[model samples]
Target: MINISQCYSTGTIKGVSKVGGLIGFCSNTTITDCYSIGNLEESPGWENAGYAREYLFRYFGGLIGTTSLGVITNCYSCGKVADVPYAGYTQYEYHGFMGPSEYGDENTVASLYFDVSKAGRTDNFAVAKSTQEMKQQNTFIGWDFIGIWRIGGGVNEGYPYLLFSYTPSEGLNVFIITDIGLKQVTEMYLITDMGLKKASQSNIIADTGLK
Candidate 1:
């Protein structure tokens, strides 16, 4: 009743039956990097006009009939599907990306973000450094995350409480900011191979030192 990474087709068959790129019916399986492009409509056997029932009982998707156990990642479809009306069937069915008959299983997805500065819209979700023109002043101020830079004075209080430090065998110094306390590090003046150097605590002192 369940299969993983498999492809199937119910060639030229006509009826109130099921067909899909992955499986006619799904159970405990994972489908990744899969796709389907075809036409699906209600068969003469059923009164329903669409390819699938909408309300409940019946579900259909372009790539899969139902997903229960497996995760579908990096998968997409460009197919035409429609639901039709019949005399006996009152409940409608779904057309695209239908779920499994039951809920609760192993399903997860990891999405990628694109760097638009370098390659523009054509870039396919690649990680790249920011250009000089894109680097504004005071980018990384109070942000706790690695790749986020905060500028200005609205940083949440109680942050950057210096945690434990250790030097690995390769002479790489690792510093963890465990507990975030009030009074965030306002500005990061410089960052080099050594470490990050903060700006003055007070604006007045920072201006005085600059002069």
Candidate 2:
């Protein structure tokens, strides 16, 4: 398990088998405001007893190798990850933020952003910005935004939205608005499973609006 906050990593792995930036194998960790730039590759190794020799299983990833349960927020990754030349079936997967292999894993973002323009090149990994203020602010364009989900550029086509499954007994019941524009507006509605309720002007608007 690994917990990273505000960091960056990059490089190339020539013959390494299992490789990753933030983590090779993760479990129950939290990563925030981080970035990864690199190319992770698998080298030729001893073939497993049951596995075939022709197909090499290479594990290469950007943010993580395998995540069972964890939380990743406000992070991004730009790199070329290739799992080849190994002695098994290769699974090549990349993420601008994180790589999750199981359910119940939480990936959250509030004013987070990512640029994967060079994802398939150079094997670069970097955290360009560490603070939430670095993201370009805009209005929420009506979409799902929540926990254990991904929201940002590249995958979501630059449309920010929360993604996650619902679990009632987790924590406090609070509505969170991520858009800076939405937080600036005065009139808004509190949406819930039951119905929509008008939010107080003071509640929706920030302190600057109050003045």
- For candidate 1, the 10 contiguous residues with the lowest summed lDDT are 157-166
TM-scores for candidates 1 onward, in order: 0.37, 0.42
Model 2 Cα lDDT, one tens digit per residue, 1-211: 5676656665664434335665666667776655555655555454543555432333345656555666666555555565344323333344343444535455443433344444342222233332233233342222223433333433233323233322223221334366443222324566656677665644434422431
Off by over 4 Å in 2: 14-18, 44-59, 83-97, 102-117, 121-211
Candidate 1 lDDT over 6-99, as tens digits, reads 2323233222444443355666566543434344455564544554454333444445555565555434333343343543431224344333
lDDT of candidate 2 vs native? 0.45
lDDT of 1 at 8: 27
Top lDDT prediction, candidate number: 2
> Which ranges of candidate 1 are over 4 A from the true structure?
1-3, 6-21, 47-57, 86-92, 103-106, 109-211
Model 2: weakest 10-residue lDDT segment is 164-173
**Residue-level error in angstroms, candidate 2, position 24:** 0.8
